[model samples]
Target chain A: MVTSRDIAQRAGVSQATVSRVLQGNSRVAPDTRERVLAAMRATDYRPHAAARAMKTRRSQTIGVVIADITNPFYPELLEAVSHALDQSGQRMILWNSAGPGEYSALQAIREGSVDGLLFTTVTEGAAPLTEALVHEEPVVLLHRGLEEAQCDQVVSDNVAGGSIVADYLVRAGHEHIGYLQGPELPSTAVHRERGFRRRLHQLGMDLRPELVGRAGFQHDTARTLIRSMLHEPVPPTAVFCANDLAAFGAIDGARSLGVHVPEDLWVVGYDDIAMAAWDSFNLTSVRQPIADLAHTAVQLLLERITDPDLPVRHELFTNSLTVRGSTAHTPLDPPAEQRDSHADD
Target chain B: MVTSRDIAQRAGVSQATVSRVLQGNSRVAPDTRERVLAAMRATDYRPHAAARAMKTRRSQTIGVVIADITNPFYPELLEAVSHALDQSGQRMILWNSAGPGEYSALQAIREGSVDGLLFTTVTEGAAPLTEALVHEEPVVLLHRGLEEAQCDQVVSDNVAGGSIVADYLVRAGHEHIGYLQGPELPSTAVHRERGFRRRLHQLGMDLRPELVGRAGFQHDTARTLIRSMLHEPVPPTAVFCANDLAAFGAIDGARSLGVHVPEDLWVVGYDDIAMAAWDSFNLTSVRQPIADLAHTAVQLLLERITDPDLPVRHELFTNSLTVRGSTAHTPLDPPAEQRDSHADD
Candidate 1:
């Protein structure tokens, strides 16, 4: 409840002097500033955020909009982003947009609660919101990108990541392959699918639409879809999942069906989350530089916030393939000899 | 920038009338209210949060203190809490306490940015903070309980859950059982250890301290601890993990040692997270009833926020055991042999 006036009265100084001292203007005399600061401490005075905002036109805060925090991927990204922001002494306000409506991002921006916005749009139909935000505030898109909107973006090369999976499967001699796509709304999914299909066509492999399933970026949904896919009369020889979580579900589903991995059906996933490294699910995946993506996104956001007139920048990081036991296949040249060798061992 | 005065001038009403109309006071005439609202809309008048806070003495916002949003468990809890608060039209301000600092929780409350605080303390030594916040604002503890602090809390029956694991292991004829403990700061861990130890003693089993491993409630840390334990001269036949995440690590550790589950060693985990049912893990765990825990915590927080005079409430929910392949063992007695009447197929 203590105000600047209380500090001013106790320090025997004018209200303007007290304000200058609290703001660290450096224009105030050192002795006077110290007196005011002492009085402020004595009175337990706290500056009102709104008053500070009105004077400086800066909140020193950024809003992070995530689709769902429960998803392991977002949390990892968030931690990186938070650390980056903390280094610059800025605070982050988290906004959850997983609800039924789609206007939380817009609502937060319109309220002018933060100096900038970091949007991780997981679903489609966020074009309007992104467009509106680009016009109103500085925004950096992370993980997911918007095709129709022009804004700063930092994302992993999902297209290349998808192709990496295709290349691996082709080299491993898997002609019959299945694909699991994420939600149709997110641009990441679209890009990955495009790259995956294009590579398959280039390799002269048939792309079966019936073999592909849409899981909407959830583990349980992916599980159900995978269960149905694997139950088909002619299952694909290999399955490439959209993400690690979905791949995990596919792996588990295949195991439940009494199908041996790699031998019966090779499974490859993307993202290469921490769980992918666990011995139980030594998943072969495409690893995205998540920490780098997060750092780039925050850096771009900070630059835009500091200089709004600067041109929008887009930074893309490449993904790499991590080969593990899940994708190990018997060499085709001596398949029978290899089988005999294993039997002899 | 347009203030209520501008709207008053446009609507041909006094500033007092404009205030009444804006606040929707019953005393304001309908026609007058409509006129003021129209004028405000035309001018695009926006209420400054600070001025509104000064007048109404409420921010309609709550602060959520989470240890780590990167943790899958906390994010799930956060999503539930956010949804519950959103239903009441309250916004959440997230403070990630996973950073290297001990006073983040206290600093957040001292700043008085939110109407109430929801604390999820992952470590011990939060007594000073809990004490400081008790007098200043409404604070609710979620998932983790503080025994010395008198505040509204909602926690699952960890002790009972732990006992359930011990009893199940004993019933399965496991003579040597290992305990994997999480960080010692949290009351949940303490209670789980107490229950497990008490049940083991009651069942006439040796509670070996050497078999107990301590991890910081993380998968990697748990994996390291379990790996070292497994390398011992004589490993326990079964291990009771503190949580599902840690349990996954234990499973991974055992798998790396070429030890088949259930056949070679039994593993039972607490908190039956979604991953527990995965074929790779198939972990037997005590279900924490997360949905119920979330609902109870939110309800208690809301009650305290609405009526500070209400007595402090501590609610506990019971947990149930979820038996899966990880804990499958031979029964003490075999089924009747059918008088050797049935022949081999």
Candidate 2:
């Protein structure tokens, strides 16, 4: 069988360069790419990458499992990952794990169709994750992570992000504040909430249980939860959401009840997604370096794929707060009429 | 070699049921699923689906190529496609063709990694697409079509959608109108612009060259273009954007220039993305039934994959106009103050 080595020798190029030319990758210089193609044609060397995979057990493909594709955050992360993989001459196959697609991605790994798996969102102790780990397939976690799993992980400082929001809200003179919690499955939610509660406690403040609402990382759920919270006898003057999507929901829900944001109820969110900058939302959020996180995670996965025995690496990226119109105004007490009307409800 | 057929015979089930169980598909009944698994265990059958594919040449994977994954419209469309593929127990491998990912997807097809290809966006008569067709591959085009291609296609009524927007604007008493056009490569842009121009002509109106701006379905590009258009000697009272993303940019741009929508100008968008309903935007847009379109497109691709000789199918879905705050107010003449300000420029 003719191999890339033979083509490389014929074209006077390295084996890696030959592989890049085979991928139709643009990184190859024009003259070198022509030489490789001419060599392949002259030798009648058929390009059957799948057939080669059976011999070498490498498919040059990676499987990416995302929580929800429609979520703006995932797409931004996915785009970054896609570009990084393209630079390395690898293909990406996606699975929307929010549905039944997770198992399919696992099956792809078992069938030797992908070199490794990169999970952007995964539940701790998921069966599929455990199965992949037991088999020693290359795995890397990004953004949302599992603490118990022994794999390469890339995460932003969620705890610090949460603490910063709490400090900002308190210093802005929000005497009464609410919290919108994300689902408890992922570490992101757990750490963010932990830091927020811890910081509030240190400051001699209490987050009354009645003022806290729990929801998945979704807009509609947060909206509904905030609406009910606003009806409490002593409603909160501010609300901090676990993520940007929930913050949008909270703002919309508050608007539906005729409550003005920042003036009546300040809102802050995490993950500075692009929509946060839109004139509609202008949401104050904690910004994670998504492009940096994505690129580093892919690099880690590739490193593990090449050397499975290397030491496990956990990368923690720092976070910053982006203050926008949502939390730009100083806190104001709820109007007497609004507070009295809530008592009627 | 222990085949699923052998397990089916022992379990008193059909071969299809065994295949479903092996795939971990949820469509099988609980009792039937248990019996199938037991039979496989009793026979000591190891699941090597890749080995089976080597024989049957069927991987049960589909390649999905999308243009610009960050665009809200693509994700909405992708979620629908992911759900449809999940139901059929087929894996979806995604490629963002906005970069160099398209060639990677074609390579997958060449290596028999995917059973067929589904294109959500493509330029007319592209080289890679032509290569796929030449190889007798099962290919389907969704939302974009090529007149010279012989593959199955699924698209919405872009021409009618454009006409509807033109009629709505004309009826709103707007004398001067503008158009924010999409890229010239895709059929969606061409047909939409053609329909809008034709309708305007029938209504005894003309779309002057100075009143039109072309961009590649992006927010920032449209924003820059609209800022310049607003400086024209006779600016438009209403602007019809090719897609919702452009409308957002147009609205943001006009606001930056102190031009209030509907009072000084009206903005309309297409694709009715989820963001369109946000209170910040509340943009009037043309709504295409994305779920229906995605499901039908997948069905066509699967049918072609199954038979390879089925008659070519082209499905066209209809679109509707969603009126919202962006165009809700009465069209006022470009205020005298605004016109005077532009003249000073």
> Among these predicted structures, which one has the highest lDDT?
2
TM-score of chain A of 1: 0.78
| Candidate maximizing DockQ | 2
Worst 10 residues of 1 chain A by lDDT: A330-339
What does the lDDT come to for candidate 2?
0.83
- True interface contacts reproduced by each model, as a fraction? 0.75, 0.72
Model 2 agreement with the true structure over B37-118: per-residue lDDT tens digits: 8888899987677776775577778899998999989999999998888766578999997324556677787788987889
TM-score of each candidate's B chain against the true B chain: 0.77, 0.85
Model 1: DockQ vs. true structure: 0.49
lDDT of 1 by residue, A165-200 (tens): 777677666656898888887878888888888888
The reply for model 1, stretches above 4 Å from the true place, is A1-51, A98-102, A122-124, A127-131, A329-345, B1-52, B98-102, B110-112, B231-233, B329-345
* TM-scores, one per candidate: 0.81, 0.85
* Maximum-TM-score candidate: 2
Please list the residue runs of candidate 2 whose C-alpha ends up more than 4 Å from where it truly belongs after superposition: A1-3, A6-47, A230-235, A329-345, B1-3, B6-47, B229-235, B257-259, B262-264, B329-345
Which residue pairs collide in model 1, if any? none
